[model samples]
Target chain A: MTYRDAINAALAEELERDERVFLLGEDVGLFGGAMAVTKGLYERFGERRVQDMPISESAIVGGTLGAVLTGLRPVAEIMFIDFVGVCMDQIVNQIAKVRYMLGGQVEVPLVIRTQGGGGKSYAAQHSQSLEAWFMHTPGLKVVIPSTPADAKGLLKSAIRDNNPVLFIEHKLLYNEKGEVPEGEHLVPLGQARVVREGSGLTIATYSRMVGLVQQAAEGLAAEGTEVEIVDLRTLTPLDEETMFASVRKTGRFLAVEEGHLTAGVGAELVARVTKNCFDYLDGPPERVAAQDRPIPCAPALEKATLPQVEDILTAARALVG
Target chain B: MPDMTVPPLPPETMRALLQGMMRVRAFEEAVHDLYQRKLLPGMSPHLSAGQEAVAAGVCLQLRPDDYMVTTHRGHGHSLLKGMDAQRMMAELCSKETGYCHGRGGTMHIASPEVGCLGANGIVGAGLPIAVGAGLSIQYRGTDQVCVAFFGDGASNQGTFHESVNLATARKLPVVFVCENNIYALSTNFARTGATPNVVDRARGYDIPGVTVDGMAVEGVYAATTTALERARSGQGPTLIEAKTYRYYGHGASDHRPYRTKEEEAQWRCSDAIQCYGDLLIERGVATAAERDDLSARAAAEAQAAVDFAVSSPDPDPARVGDYVFA
Candidate 1:
């Protein structure tokens, strides 16, 4: 199944399983979502459960917060992660702070699903990975699934989570096909999976970057360098144990991310590995991330702006050297 | 204007309304005293001293199952919505026994049991949430109606316009109550909007909009009753703008530097609690001694709440990291 189909299946199952679960967003109902992930949900669930919201991002988020407080579990889509800037107040201040500030008086069981990545040449506004922004927040659980199986499992987990979660899907990974488990596949949040095992180096990445890292790992393996690839399913409650174990075994670390280099998730991973496994390292940890610039509309320019497989390979070679 | 005919309410109902306003006034007075004595925390208190009628009148019309979203100046609304006075005082005092276990101070006090979603700190954030609750009610096929209580200043917020439009488009069961207190902090209502009245802007949403004298409790109550009736019958939402004023400054420390003393005195002359009490007596609904007894009882209750808050234990430091997530 495709990653998009997996997400659609998760939404469909959750909506069927729980009466309180509903989906609302721009073009999500009749338009079947801009990504077509919600193509048949409106017909299956009807207009009441699958709703088409107005263009107001603030209302979409704020309304979800309100609905969750009452009884309903609302899965709201922001269409694209870049547009989250318009509704940051509701996300950062209201939704993120409600559970903490309310002293656990209320549980905000809400899932905000959005897609982010730069490969589609969708320009500066539409294509950007902003997982680091939500990872820094205290009350939010940030999840980014790399594969079809992970996407389906993580989405179901996020839906069942009693706290507010930012379920980020990579725009480039929607069409990527992979075998997914048939039923009741639930990947717990804050757990990392070792997609490939090796002893020479640990290549830590998430979302779309995981594929690039895997391609780089395969090329490195051809040259007798076995690279361990760790796909971090969730970011906020990071799987430090899995990362530390891999870094300990490989004695080399390279964090790859699609977001910008400066103060990105890659930087955090490098800092964490360096601090925790300083004794196990052969050399300084390395990182491969998008350049600190807005993604341009041109295909070559956007490709150059983002970190590619060659960049991951070079970063990995340096880390292993 | 000629004398308006006062609606004849039962003696019990009249006393209840008067006592509700009295409780709010007394509770705010005690809170002010606590702040002055430096007994409470350093947070600024947004007192609804003069706008008690709007809170009491509108909330009285709501069923226990109905939901309400309030503003930063939400003490009166919270009190009338049946939030425990002692727990509310404890919350303001930062005691663990508070409504939110001392996490949400005054601006975010919530009691979902009484159907108050929360009191928002943002200017117009509660409007959309109220609409969402309305949507939930409609989806569940419940008879519950949600009310969003905001100020005239919040009407200028985009959330207010967006929420009203959505509520109308979906015909959500909700009521939008605008407490026009004439000022958003120091800014006058005229300086904030192109329209002279908040109710005038409701025409664009195509909902029933009415303006009532907020100082007259009966007028607010009557308008709210009609709005609730319309909402419960699935007639969609109603916008009721109550023309009210704040006797105190925006916060406890704010002095009378923004408006003229004459203007302040003019509003104080028609204070909601004072007018309602006078009307009750003039209509022979209650005697003078009975009204005075209610005032004493309310003052005693306020004092008891203060004592309870003061004596309440602080949260343990070991549990400080709790409640970040469910």
Candidate 2:
């Protein structure tokens, strides 16, 4: 199944499993979502459960937060992660802080599903990875799934979590097909999956970057450099144990991410490994991330700016050296 | 236009309305005193001393299951909607016994039991939330209506326009109540926009918009009653702009440098509590002595709440991370 199909399956299954679960966002109902992830949900759940909202991003988030406050579990889509800037106050201040600020009296069981990444050449306004922005927030749970099965499992988990969660889907990974589990599949959040195992080096990444790093690791293995790849399914409650264990075995670490290099998720991972697993390190930790600049619409510039397989291989080689 | 005639309510009902207004007034008065004593932390209190009638009128029409979202200056609305005074005072004092365990101070008090979703610190933020609650009610097939209490300044926010349009498009059960106190902090309402009245802007949303004398409790009650009826009957939302005024400045330390003393005196002459009390006595709903006694009781209740807040213990420092998640 494709990652898009897996997300749709998760939403459909959750909607069927719980009566309080509903979908609300722009083009979610009639247009079947901006990326067709919610295709046919309107017909299946009807218009009442599958709601189409206005172009207002603030209302989409604020409305979903409000619905969660009162007895409904709503999965709201922001279409793209770049557009989150329009509703930062609602996402950052209101949704992220509501549960904690309310002293746990109310549980904000809300899932904000948005797409990020820059390979499509959608220009500066549309294609920017902003996972670091949410990871910095205190009361939010940020999740970015790299594979079809993990996407399905992690989305289901995010919907079930009593706190608000930001479920980031990479736009580039939507068409990537893989074997997703058939029935009752649930991947517990805050748990990392070791996709590829090796003793030479540990390559940590998530979302679309995981695929690039895995490919790079395969190429590195051809050169006698066995690189282990760890896919962090969730970011905020980061699977530090799995990361630390992988780094301890490998004695070398390289963090890869599609977001900006400055204060990005890769920076956080590299910092964590340096802090906890310093004694086990064979060499200094390294990071492979996008350059500190907006993603341009030109394909060449965008590809150059984003972290590619070659960049990961270079970072892995440096860490091994 | 608002119906200025006294609502033909029973003597007990009228007395209750007067007492509700008095409670709001007394509560805010005590908040002013508490701030003066430096007991409350964070931002200074925004008192709703002259706007009690709007709170009494609108909240009295709501059932316990009906939801409400208020603005930063929302103490009056919360109190009238049945929020516990002790817990509210505790919240103002930043104690663990507060509504939000001292995390959400004055601007973020919320009580789902009382149907208050929360008090928003951002201008016009609660409008969409109220619309969402309205959508939830419609989805669940409930008769409950969600009331959004915003200031006139918030009416200028894009959220106000967006939420009203969505509520109208979906025909949701939500009432947009604009408490037009004529000032967004220092900026006067007239200086902010070309439209003279907030209700006039509701025409673009295709909803019924009405203006009521906010200082007159009966007028506000009558307007809100009609709006609630329309919402409960699935007639969609109504924008009711209450023409009110704030007797105090924007915050506790704000001296009235923006406006003249004469303009302040002009608004104070139509204070909601004083006018409502006079109306109650004139209509023979209650004797003057009875009205005075009710006011005194309200003051005593406010004092008791302050005492409870003062005696409440501070939150344990060890449990600071208790409510970050679920």
Candidate 3:
């Protein structure tokens, strides 16, 4: 199934399983979603279950928090991840802190589905990775799945989670096809899967970066450098055990991410490896992330800015040496 | 508008309304005294001392299961909506026995049992959350309505406009209650608002907008009931602008540098609790003795709450990480 189809299936399955689960966003229903991730959901669920909201991001997020507080598990879409700036207060202040500050009196069982990453030359605002923003928040869980199967499984888990989750999908990965489990596929959050296990060096990444790293790892393997690829699916509860164990074995670490290198998720990963596996490290950890600038609309500039297959190969070759 | 005749209500309800105002007034007075003594920590509590009638009048129309979201000055609404005064005071004291286990202070108290979603620290933030609750009710096919209580200052917030437009567009069952305390923090509504009334803005959303004498509990009660009926019957949201005033400064320790003492005194002439108490006696709902006895009881309750807070243990330092997740 395609990544988009997998998400639609997960939504359909969750809606079928739980009566409380519903979908709402700016073009989710009738429009079949902006990316068509929620295609055919409106027809199956009807208007009551599949709500199409106005272009009010504050209402979309804050309203979802309120609904979850009152026993509804709503999957709200923000159309684009960049649009989150419009409703940062509702997302960061209200939804993120409501559960913790309210003394755990209620659970915000909701998911904010938004797409990030800069492959389509969508320009500065539309092509940004903001998973680190949600990871910084205390009460929120951030989920970013790379493959179609992981996408379906993680989305299911996210919707069923008792806490607020920011399920980020890559706009470029919508059509990436993989064999999604036909039914009852559940990938737990906070678990990093080893995509390519090797003995030489560890390259940890997530989302679309995981695929790019895998391709780079195949090339590195041809050069007699065995690079292990760890896909950090859930960023917040960050599976430190898998990362540290991989680093401890390899004695060399390189963090790859599509987000900006400054204060990015890669920055945090590198910091963690340096602190936890300092004595085990053969050399200092390296990070290959997007340049600290806005993603440009030009194809050549965008590719140069973001981490690429060749960039990963160079970073891995240097780390292995 | 109908004549300002007092609607005949059950004697018990009349007495409850009177007692509710008294409780809110006395509770805020106690909180004010605590601030004066430097017993409270963090930001000074935003007391809803003079605006008790608006809370008493509007909340009386809600069921225990109906949801409500209030603003920074939300003590009155939370108390009237069934939050225990002792726990509320304990929360203000940052004690473990508080409603939020001492995490949420005066500005952030919440109780799901009483259907109060929360009291937000941000201006106009509760509007959209309340609309979400209304949407929940619609999806669940329940008759419940949500009351979103914000101040006049929040009327200009983007959330206020977005929430109202969305609520009316969805025809969600919500009552947008604006406590027109004439000021948002220190700025007067006259300077901040486009019109003298916050309800006039509702016309833009095409919802029924009504203004009531927030100083008079009966008038507020009547206006709220009509709005509640309209909401529960699927007629959609109503904007209620309660022209009220806050007796104290925006927060504790804020002197009246923004307004004149004469202006403050003029507005306090019709104190909600005092006027409602006198009206109860005149209508034969309660005697002067009964009113005095209720006031005494309210004072005792406030005193008891303070005592409870003072005696309650502070939250455990070790469990600081607790309650961050489910």
Candidate 4:
């Protein structure tokens, strides 16, 4: 199944399982989503369950929060991650702080699904990986799935989570295909998977960057340099055990991410590796990430702005050296 | 006797309305005294002293299962919705016995049992959430309605328009009540708003808009009842703007620098509680002795709540990290 198809299946199954679960977004119903990930959901679930919302981002998020408070599990889509800026108050202040502020009198069972990352040449506003913003927040759970299997499993788990979750999908990985388990395939949050194993170095990455790192690992293997790749599916409930264990075994760490280099998830990974496994490391950790600049629409400029396979190979080789 | 152009409500209903306004006045006066004495910590109390009738009128019409969301100046709304005055005072005092266990403090008290979604600190933030509550009621096919109480200031916020648009588009069962107390903090509503009245903006959405005399509890109550009936029957949302005034400054610290003493005196002459008391007596609903007795009881009730808040325990410092999730 394609990653898009896997997400679609997860939504379909969850909507069927829970009577309270509903989906609302811009163009999600009739247009089948801008990415076409929600194709045929409106017909299957009807207008009540699958609502088409106006371009009011604040109402979309705040309204979803109100629904969850009064007993309803709603999945709201922001169309693109860039559009999140329009309703940051709803997401940060209202949704994230409501439960804690209310002293746990209520649980915010909400999921905000949006597509992000650089690669589509969609320009500065449309193409950006902003997971680090949500990861910094205390109450939110951040999940980004790379594979079709992980996408399906993790999404189901996110839907059932009581706390509010920001489920980020990559524009580049929607068509990526893989084998998805048939029934009840659930990947618990805060668990990391070792996609590829090696002894010399460990590469920490997530979402679309995992593919780039894997391709880099293959190229490095031909040159007799072994690299282990850890795909961190969930960012907020970070599986430090898996990361620390891998870093301790390899004695080296390199983080590859599509977000900007400054204060990115890569920076957090490096700090954590240094703090926890300083004695186990042979040298300081390294990172390969997007350039600290607005992503231009030109294909070549966009490629140069983002972390590519070559960038990962260079960063990995230096870390392994 | 005063001119009785309209028939008076039953004596029992009239007494309830008068007492409701008196309770709000007493409770807010206690909050003011607590702040002055430095007993209440955290935020400076934004007392809804003079605007009691709006809360009493609108909230009295709501059932326990019906949802309501209010503004920063929301002690009146919380109390009218059946939240304990003692616990609310404790919350203002940041005690463990508070509604939010001292976590939410003055601006974020919420009781699910009473159907209060929350007391939002952000201006105009409650409207969209009210839209959501309406959506939940509609989605569940329940007869419940959600009322969103905001200020004339909040009507200028983008959420006000967006929320109203969505609610009307979906024909969600929500009532948008605007308490036009003429001020958004120190700035007068006229200085900030393009329109003279908040109800004028409702026409842009093509929904029914009603303006009521907020100083008169009966006016607010009648308008709210009509709105509630319209919402409960699935005719979509209605915007009710209650024209009123605030007796005190924006916050406790704010003195009367913006408005004139003449203006203050004019509003105080038409004080909601005092006027309602006279109206009750003139209409033969209650005697002067009975009205005085009600006022005294409200004062005693507010004093008892203050005592409860003062004696309540402070939250344990060790549990500060709790409630960040679940």
Per residue, candidate 1 scores C-alpha lDDT tens digits across B285-316 of 88899899999988998999999999999988
Q: Candidate 3: lDDT of B281?
A: 89
Lowest lDDT 10-mer window, candidate 1 chain B? B1-10
For all the predictions, what are the DockQ values? 0.80, 0.81, 0.86, 0.86
Clashing residue pair totals per candidate (backbone < 3 A): 0, 0, 0, 0
Cα RMSD (Å) between model 2 and the true structure? 1.1
**Chain B TM-score of all predictions, in order?**
0.97, 0.98, 0.97, 0.97
Which stretches in model 4 have alpha-carbon errors above 4 Å?
B1-8
Which pairs clash in the backbone of model 2? none
Encode model 3's per-residue lDDT on A1-321: one tens digit a residue.
Answer: 999999999999999999999999999999999999898999999998899999999998999988998999999999999999999999999998988788888888999999999899999999999898888888889999999999999999999889889999999999999999877999998999999899899999999999899899889889998988899999977999999999999999999999999898888999999999999999989999999989999999999899999999988888877
lDDT of each residue in B34-60, candidate 4, tens digit only: 999999897788899999999999898
User: What overall lDDT goes with each candidate model?
Assistant: 0.91, 0.91, 0.91, 0.92
Error of 1 at B186 (Å): 1.2
Which residues of candidate 1, in runs, are more than 4 Å off? B1-7
lDDT tens digits by residue: candidate 2, A1-321: 999999999999999999999999999998899999999999999998999998988888899977887899999999999999988989898989987887888998999999998899999988999999999999999999999999999999999999899999999899999999889899888999999999999988999988888899889999899988899989988999999999999999998898999999888899999999999998889888999988989999999999888888887777776
lDDT for model 3 = 0.91
